[model samples]
Target chain A: AQSVTQPDIHITVSEGASLELRCNYSYGATPYLFWYVQSPGQGLQLLLKYFSGDTLVQGIKGFEAEFKRSQSSFNLRKPSVHWSDAAEYFCAVGSAEGYSTLTFGKGTMLLVSP
Target chain B: EAGVTQFPSHSVIEKGQTVTLRCDPISGHDNLYWYRRVMGKEIKFLLHFVKESKQDESGMPNNRFLAERTGGTYSTLKVQPAELEDSGVYFCASSQGYGETQYFGPGTRLLVL
Candidate 1:
């Protein structure tokens, strides 16, 4: 069984400040990783996903994440966050086999302050 | 194309009552899934439907919850004798195929009082 751990429950970043949300996963083999964001009253939107090839994957909204096998981590990062970036972010892990059944972390709520 | 849509964005029912949630996945999507998020908890998978057949239902909490996807189009989840513990947000997601990126719905916020 695979699982995701997001140490931070909530993160507050000032507007125009950089942001980093940590995520770690426990899986037996190579895992497919993803980042999703959900704004108030909105559906979960895919930020980015790492399947194969490049270790660094860029996503929509100027977000990027890197897959570090040694660290078992796929942390989401943004050079500068805006007030509109306030939302809840989730880190999920999946496998090529039945990866559709994703294992998600508890999620980290990002708050952008003025 | 329309993203996955769930009916009754919010549902409030008393304990022991019954509630049914509906999900309409994107057209041409072959995989549909159900997930739930309890207050302050992680979103957990409830089941997966591959077309009209249930591919995996290992995460279903109990028999009080029943899910069906007939004709391989839309899906429904019914909770009979709902309990307080059942209060949560139920989300529906769809994917084109195996290992594909899943598109999620806005979710139905179910509150059992």
Candidate 2:
């Protein structure tokens, strides 16, 4: 079974500050990792994904994540956060061998302050 | 392109009542999925449908929940005799094919009182 763990329940960052959201996973093999953001009253939007290749993957909205195989982690990062970036973020893992059904982490709520 | 869509953005029902949620997947998408997020809990998978066929339903909670995808188009999830524990946001997603990236719909929030 694949499981995702996000250590932070909530995080606040000032505008223009660099931000990082931690995520860890447990899977049998190389898993398909993803970061999704859910704004208020909206659906989850894909931020980025890591299937293979480059460890650092870029995503929409100036977001990026690094896949660390040694640590079993895929952490999302941004060089600078804007106030509009405040939202709920989820880290998910899917089986590369199966139907790609995702196992999501308890989301971390981000609050961007000015 | 149109995204996955769900009906009845919010539903408030009595504990013993029944509620049915609907989902319209993106056109040409053959894979549809149902997921839910209970308060303070991680979003959990409920079921997966591959063109009207049940690919996986191991995540379904109980028999009280029934899901159907007629003609392999839109899907519906019916919950009978709802409980407070069932109060949460139910999301529908669709993908072009197996192992592809899924597009999610704005979830339907169900509150059982």
Candidate 3:
């Protein structure tokens, strides 16, 4: 079985401040990792994904995540956050076989302040 | 292109009543999935459909839950004799193919009183 863990339940950051959200996963082999963001009353939007290759992957909305195999972590980061970035973020892990379902983390609620 | 769409954005029903949720996937998508978030719990997978066939349903909670995808265009999930624990947000997602990135719907928030 696969599982994902997000240590932070909520985080607050000031506008123009750098932000990082922690995510860890337990899987047998190399897993496909993803980060998604959801605003109130909206569906989740994919931020970024890590399949293979470069450890640092760029995503939409100036978001990026680094895959650390040694720590089993895929942490999302942004150089600077805007007030509009406040939302719920989820980290998920899936199998490379393609048919396996995704296992998601509990999600971290982000609060951006001015 | 239009994303996955779900109908009846919100639903409220008694514990013993029944509710049906609908999902219309993106055109040409071959994979559709159902997931739910209960209270503070993580989003959990309920089932996966490849076209009109159910590929996986191991995550379904019980027999009270039934899902059908007729003709492979859209899908419906019916919950009968709903329990209080069933109050949560149900989301539908679709992908162009297996292992591809999934596009999610706005979700239906079900509240059982």
Candidate 4:
């Protein structure tokens, strides 16, 4: 079974400040990793995904994540966060071996302040 | 292109009542999936459908939950004699094919009182 852990339940960051959301996973093999963001009353939006590519993958909305195999982690990052970036972010792990079913973390709520 | 869509954005029902949720996948998508997120918990997978066939349903909680995808189009999940623990946000997702990136719907929030 694949499981993901997001240590931070809540995080606060000032506008224009760099942000990082930690994510760790336990999978038997190389897993498909993803970051999703959900704003109020909206569906989960895909941010970035790592599926056998460069360790650092870029995504929409100026988001990026690095996949470190040795650490079993895929952490999301942004150079600078905007107030609009405040939302709940989730880290998920999947695999073709598992029929592409995703196992998600508990999620990290980002609170961006001015 | 239209994204995956779910009906009855919010549902409030009695604990013993029944509720049915609907999901319309993106046109031409061959894979549809169901998931649930209990408040403060990680989202959990419920089932997977390939066309009109059930590919995997190991995550389904019990027999009270019945999901059907007729004609390989839209899908419906019916929960009968619902329990308080069944109250949660149910999400539907669709993908073009197996192992592809999935697009999610807004989700149907079911609250059982």
- The whole-model lDDT of each prediction reads 0.96, 0.95, 0.95, 0.94
How close to the true structure is residue A47 of candidate 4, measured as C-alpha lDDT? 95
Residue-pair clash count for candidate 2: 0
Best by the DockQ measure: 1
Q: Listing candidates in order, what is each one's chain A TM-score?
A: 0.97, 0.97, 0.97, 0.96
Question: Per-residue lDDT for B5-111 in model 2, tens only?
Answer: 99999999999999999999999999999999999999999999999999999999999999999999999999998999999999999999899898899999999
Instruction: Tell me the TM-score of model 1.
Output: 0.99
| lDDT of model 1 at position A81 | 99
Residue-wise lDDT of candidate 3 within A1-114, one digit each (tens)?
Answer: 899999999999999999999999999977999999999889889899999999999999999999999999999999999999999999999887775488999999999988
DockQ of 2: 0.81
Q: Write the per-residue lDDT of candidate 3 for residues B5-94, one digit (tens) a residue.
A: 998999999999999999999999989999999999999999999999999999999999999999999999999999999999999999
**Candidate 4, which segments miss by more than 4 Å at Cα?**
none
Model 2, TM vs. native = 0.99
Q: How well is each residue in A1-114 modelled by candidate 1, as lDDT tens digits?
A: 899999999999999999999999999988999999999999898999999999999999999999999999999999999999999999999896557599999999999999
List, residue by residue over A1-114, the lDDT tens digit for candidate 2: 778999999999999999999999999987999999999989999899988899999999999999999999999999999999999999999877666489999999999988
- Minimum summed lDDT over a 10-residue window in model 3 chain B is located at B97-106
Residue B14 of candidate 2: its Cα lDDT? Answer: 94
Candidate that beats the other on DockQ, 1 or 4, i.e. the better one = 1
The TM-score values for the models, in the order shown, are 0.99, 0.99, 0.99, 0.98
DockQ order of candidates, best first?
Answer: 1, 3, 2, 4
Residue lDDT tens for model 4, B59-105: 99999999999999999999999999999999999999898898899
* True-structure lDDT of candidate 1: 0.96
Docking class for model 4 is medium
